[model samples]
Structures are given as structure tokens and as C-alpha cells.
Target: MVFADGTERPCGGLLVPVTLHQRTGLAAQLGAALAAPTPLTAEGLATPKMPGETSVRGLFVAGDATGQMPSVANVIASGSTTASAIVGRLTGAT
Candidate 1:
């Protein structure tokens, strides 16, 4: 797994397994994998975000990070959509 800083960590009780790149593409994939799943709470998974923000300016969020369905196809679609959105937003078009 990978730490937030992109450092590799041990997995499966092994001193080392796969590289961090082999894991999720998002930040702190290791934290997500190790984190215990729980029901969403107002103070937990449902964090607040700034108003009028579609995505952080010039920084787009896609895939599972954006709460979309998880799958290879979904991820690919998310990437394409994010790229299109970014381009459109930068170009000042809807």
C-alpha cells in the first residue's frame, strides 16, 4: 500500500509486496484499504466542501474519489469525463 506522501508500505504481512503504483491511483490508498468500513455519518464520510466548486480549480477529482461507481470501465469513464470537464471549464464553456 501507499502512504499519503506516496511512500510504499508493507502489505499482506510481507516486508514488501507490490509497488505503491500497483495500488489505487488516489491519495493514501493504503489508508483506505486498511480503514474499516462503516456507515456514513455526517461527521464521517460526508465531509463538507466549498460552495460553487465543481472541482478544485485546475484540479479535478474522478473515479472513486468522486463517489462514482467502482470498476475499470467506470474509472476510465471518470477520467475521460474529468478531462473533458477540465478542458471545458478552462475554456469558459459549459
Candidate 2:
């Protein structure tokens, strides 16, 4: 998915297939990077947050960046759990 800065990152391990809409210069560069067949690095795994605190308040992080889970399904589940946690925190139930 596109990051806050519009940088599109490839989520490895076949979680979801990407469709190239426009053959822009940046897209071509990403295509070349993927074509190398080398293992994708974890260099850019950090989340791009909006200006303010380190993370969004009351919204805890999970999955890859948070070192929780790496799989797609796990990430999805973590996101759901995070949402629940946020709601709980907001409602003073947590």
C-alpha cells in the first residue's frame, strides 16, 4: 500500500497481488527492484506517522512494525484487535 509520503512498498510473501496501473518512472524502478529476486529487506518497515506523537494516541500498533506477526492474516487480525483495543480505551473499558 502507498505510505503517507506516497511511497509504495511491496508487502512480501504473496499476501496480496499488486496491479500496476500506470507505468510511471517510479513504478519502473519498483519493478526492477522486485525483478532482482533478492530477499526484500526490512529497512523501510517503520510506519509513516502524521506530524505529532510517535504513534496515534489510543491506537496501539501490531504486526510487522510492532514485531507482533509477519503474515498477512496475522496482520489483519492484529489490526482488528488494535481497533478493539482503541475502542475499549476510548470507552474506558480497558
Question: Which prediction has the highest lDDT against the true structure?
Answer: 1
Query: Which stretches of candidate 1 lie above 4 Å from their native place?
Result: 1-55
* Each prediction's whole-model lDDT (CA): 0.44, 0.43
Cα lDDT tens digits, model 2, 18-61, are 32222233423333221112133222122234211113343345
Report the lDDT of model 2 for residue 14: 54
The TM-score values for the models, in the order shown, are 0.41, 0.38
Worst 10-residue lDDT window for candidate 1 reads 39-48
What does the lDDT come to for candidate 1?
Answer: 0.44
Off by over 4 Å in 2: 1-59
Model 1, residue 77: distance off in Å is: 0.5
